[model samples]
Target: MPWKHADMVRWLHPQHLIRSGMDALVASIFGVRADHRLIVAVGRPQPPYFDYSDEAAGEDFWLDYVADTGDGWNSTYAVARLLAKPSLELKDPNGDTHALERGRILVFGGDQVYPGASRDTYEERLAQPYREAMSRSPDPSPHLFAIPGNHDWYDGLAAFMRLFCADRWFAGRRTRQSRSYFALKLPRGWWLVGTDVQLNSDIDVPQLEYFRQTATYMQPGDRIILCNAEPAWIHAATTPHPRGYMENNLEYLQEKVFGRRISLFLAGDLHHYKRHEDAEGRQKITAGGGGAFMHPTHAPRALRLRDGCEQKKCFPDEKTSRELTRQNLMLIRHSPFFGLLTGALYLILALSAYTELGSHGLLNIHEALRQLAASLVNRPMSLVVGAATLGGLVGFADPAFGRWRVPMGLVHGLAHIACAFLVAWGAMYFTVSTLGICAEPPSPKLAAFIIPGANACAGGWTHMWAKFLLGTFLTFAGGFLVGPFVMGLYLTVSLNNFGAHSNEAFISLAIPDWKNFLRLRIDPEGQLTVYPVGLERVPRKWKATHADRYSPAYDPDDPQATDPILIEPPVRVMPREQAP
Candidate 1:
């Protein structure tokens, strides 16, 4: 329980000030020096893009991005192999085979690992896997960069900073950026700006100033590719304008600090892939599908559609998104390990109840069941009536059950809770009446029940009444707390699977086995193309490299794949907004 106590306290720290304090203490003791130097670089050349654009005197560049997908438990080994491979080998939907080349720069979006951001977690989850990938590849390693996500900040960014910022070889690549944020200067007046949102707090003064100085070096017409740690705009529940500090800061950087136009805005906290373009042709893409669990493409909270944006154009169509959502929900239902764990928890709870009551001579299993059944003789009618009434009301309000889901669930859950309390009271009354414990006088004193730690007694009829009242109250209270919790979980799972529609906010699915990433190539003319690669199997080199490590990190005996297949027909990046 003490080990679990830390986790309870840690989650309570939503602002993460406590974690930050711990990080400060850790850094002081370890003599950890934080880095914040910006790195600028020219992009790699791409012949196809250069040939297509034609008038190319400048160089070309490519950057691959993925986020919220660091899963050391599964997929990371295969993902590492894919990254190490020179190019993807795959067949398109038309059965045409092609090799999609790897990007020259590999930029991680964030959330490098699940559970927490500890050094051991990073070593196994990210560093060791990628390091092996680099070693197995014959080609030179691409320049590696990373921005911290909220998960990375869970341990106050200690491991993230060590892996991505400090001047050392991690994952078989030297840390290039001095800070969590950096600016990559591309050929032909293009720039890649990565920012640290600092765990939902405002951008630190140093980071803001660093970007301002970087902006001073740029011209007004420069095409900028913006990258952030979280998708603040899409995550907003009510409206896009209200819950968007990241957007506000980026807007200020574009309009005031730099006076430049943004070509592409990229973020990856949502753990799924999405592309949304405004009327002005500015692209806002969320591509977090790296290797972690998948998320659903739910509808945004606001029902109103934006001007000039159709259903599928703004986001995936409802049918398509729903299918994706279903796939994830089904994955959870069929997960062998998850089901096993749930069963284990129920067993533990049952055992705990039996142990506590058995020790106090309060539990007689056969007698308890017999009394429980007798108590429930007249109970079914009330539950049936309540459920039927609620069901009728729900059906009348919304046949599809979309708009009224939350309110309906809450009301129905409360009814079930009340029923549980009544059942508990009846069962307890039957048990105590049959056992005759209530008939015993308190500590052999006068015919009465005495308070445990008080000089108080209720004699004669009052003693029996007091015992029954206390038993009923305690049982009802326990049942009231537990019944609604179980009912809520069941209803939520049902709605998540069969009901709820998503836009970009209501993510309630885990896309199992479909690991993906994005490769963006900028031509000499400053035009960008995006290739979304999905892994269908593990790579051969991944199986061979550090083969022994697989057992501890991931069981090789498990029925996962050995080679990865890529998703076909990559999406082309539309042209940036024309320079004003």
Candidate 2:
């Protein structure tokens, strides 16, 4: 079946790209980080940190963490419904079951909306689905706290402020926090601190000061669970990178301000779950799998761990991730609009070299090949298309690709050029041979195309138009069928073999599987156990349940609706010891 538009976000969709690009440019110029200054000055919520030290559950309670959410209906709602459960029970391979209770506090690590942030998008992509799931949650509303991801930052935190900072009700969850970043001082000296690092740059001075002040209230032995939008540790580990600051800034907060008491570092953005643990048991975990399309965990850089931390566990695992990259072969299966763009490019190149194509039909392969080579040299428009293709691929290459970008981009771009020429020849053959639109084709070079007299005298406007329209349509059809194949093949190879285009390959897939979220429980001893839950698949068939009718508005019709699997065993972060 072809992709359902309602199920996933089409990142390549023109509207999304245009909006995201415009929003990013505007935010950079205006410096919207100032919104945090206004949020603090107004003091609407009065304080930067909300102290949850005296909860009804005392030192023991559940906390939910999810991020990189708000892309597709099926994926976002699938995770939302699971998170709203009164209790979630899953067994490890050994069959020891862990029954996790509903969280008293639900934290969105970042990227609450896909592509870009706008009130309408937030309302539909983030609010509507989560709220629909929340409709059935047996509740004493959970406290909702969130930090803005890059997409959220694209609109300068306006929509994020309206939703998360307004101190209103959302999806049966009470929204808290007066800013894009927040601090939750939980019971038994456990603190959950969320920071806003807009677009993976430095934390704003105001946000830095906010955390520094929040840090002042912490006790010496208190343990902090630090949450950030990006995994700076991963950035630092990967080389040809900027010397430090971003990671160091986070380090300064953890080491200087928080006194090295941060036991867990949590984040989202990559849209997959990965945990790295050091010898001392300090964990840096990326749990961005709330929703949105899957990011490949099989990529080489994704596996790189910094500061003596080993790769502890990851959702889908590396093997499964590699196998899934093969789905890129069917790129048009989801994003058909991409084919239109490629088809136009193919039509442009073909129309530009019409004299050559007409002279040597594809059946005359040797001469056609020679003519295409000459056309590339002689035809100005063909050269323009070739240059443009190369330039676009170079721009598409990720910054992380380093110097390898130019060569890899050149190869990928060349493939498209070759494919376009091949497709153009094929389209021309179909128009002349199969459709028989063109008349008097037995000619070389100028004679092949110099048939305005023959075309006009043959039949008049009807005959002329039949050739023009049919030729144009066949050219477009050839490109529509073959263009995306070339692109998808390049992306698949680039991502899996070359460690480039990780974003492009997976977003095109709109994979709703490997969906996951985290469940954290702080016991009486202040030991925090993290349970990473994963769904191998999301249900496409859903219906209103009549049994209780009070259950989640939609339930999967398939009895075998993908069961939640434990991505890994629970990870325990022991609290720091108190001063003697």
Candidate 3:
């Protein structure tokens, strides 16, 4: 049987629904955190981005967006270099030498690879690269650990289990995890707790029980560094967005498991770096810049409410937001992929128009526009317009909207609707302008060319129009649904694997080459410091030189040409008790 687009959509619909339902279930079950003794720490370390085999196979149609070879400064080479010299030299507040050991346990927040979880892709993209890195390095390997992110769960966790839970080895690194979630007892009363937040902050029964059992051994004043795949708190801090799912999950974990003992909470998924401190002095850091498309740090205008969803007053204002916006601009100017995607979409739309307009020159562009306009005069269109207007009004109802322009559900929904309408209109115009004007009756061969199965069809003019309208409607609806609003959100919200795999409509979004990772170090005196390392220094002409494209891998032999540099000074975190 031949595969149909509708069939593929049907198959994928339930799979996505299942994942969503599972997230809801997990959130319900572990909705509230429960108390327990400290359990024995499980030592398991895994690499980042679960899949990257696109190039290893034939040229993948989509995986190129997320695949990385680590040959360049951003992938395993830079990270491996850091691991080679596994410790950093620092100074205490008193100016004394403070030696910080690069963690013996390497915790991967999540997203081991891209375009879904498969062992082959993992081996090609993750393990071998790290193995190569370790082979070249002089330092002993650290115990690798990981927590499953959404990408890992996309394939039903099969690849994730095989790679991490089944004692698989990536180069010299071994996966020691018995399950996805684990507790690690570190030195100096420090504990690393990594949780799986696959769907809606959900934890499976066994994993929850494991943590519950693990909590029994906890001592008072014990500090925790919580690791999760999604940056829920940062998301929650956004205003007028469904206020607190992530915050609730974190609260659950903090109140029940550690009892406010969490010193620092770390999360990935967003391919950028950000840090936030709340009124309670709880530190939430997003260090996901781990070799995926770089996320823009610019504070997005709240799509829902005024004062834009900044809970804890954490969103950076004008002056500080520029840095992120600058990076975003650089990506836009440098990457040519987005432009290619847009052009491709237009071409496809034009060809599809040809199929309908070529054989039967019956439909006139002007008449279609007239009919469309006349149709919109009906009640349905009015209601749609009215509803959209109402939504916008309610969204901007918040007094802060006057100053901040935060968007709400109504606003976002209206934007989508508006985008759909505009797209439908534009599609019609472009189709008619190109195909309608030159449309002519097709010859026998031309007819066959226009419709692949034309010979099998037994139909008159009515039948031709029937097929044309049906096909055109479906095509137009699809283009309308995934229109500008959806594309804009991909950039603004930074969701859906940072638009990896060409899931997004336009090519305006550019993936950067700065590959990043974090080293979580605990000093002899128990102070926790984090060092964010990029594979190479972001080139000075990055904006100009990388305007067209950036390389994923660098020369392995000339590793020193782009040695990993610490992007910022070491951040010394205050212990949980001292945070306030």
**lDDT (0 to 1) per candidate:** 0.52, 0.76, 0.47
* TM-score attained by model 3: 0.57
Per-residue lDDT of model 3, residues 1-580, tens digit only: 4211110111123353465456545434533333111121234333212221122132111100111222222343445434434454544334454444545456777877653456765665566545544532224444567777766665556677677777655545555775677777765666678887655565545456666766776677667778888766655545345445634544566677667677677887765566655444455666665555444444432222221222222222234433443333333243323333333343343332232222322256555445445544533534555464546545533332333334444554555444444444454344443445224443353344244322212344544565455445644554533543343453334322222212221113334345556666554556667665544332212111121111212233432345454545555566645732
- Cα-based lDDT at residue 388, candidate 3: 49
TM-score against truth, every candidate: 0.62, 0.91, 0.57
**Higher-TM-score candidate of 1 and 2:** 2
Model 1 residue 144 distance off true place after TM-score fit, in angstroms:
1.1
Badly placed stretches (over 4 Å) of model 3 are 1-77, 84-102, 136-140, 239-250, 278-282, 300-510, 535-563, 576-580
Q: Give the runs in model 2 whose Cα sits over 4 Å from its true position.
A: 1-5, 32-45, 56-59, 136-140, 244-248, 300-304, 356-363, 373-378, 439-465, 546-551, 575-580
Best model number under TM-score = 2
Put the candidates in TM-score order, highest first.
Answer: 2, 1, 3
**lDDT agreement of model 3 with the native:** 0.47
Clashing pairs in 2: none
Candidate 3: Cα lDDT at 134? 53
The stretch of ten residues in a row with the least summed lDDT in candidate 1 is 1-10
User: How many residue pairs collide in each prediction?
Assistant: 16, 0, 38
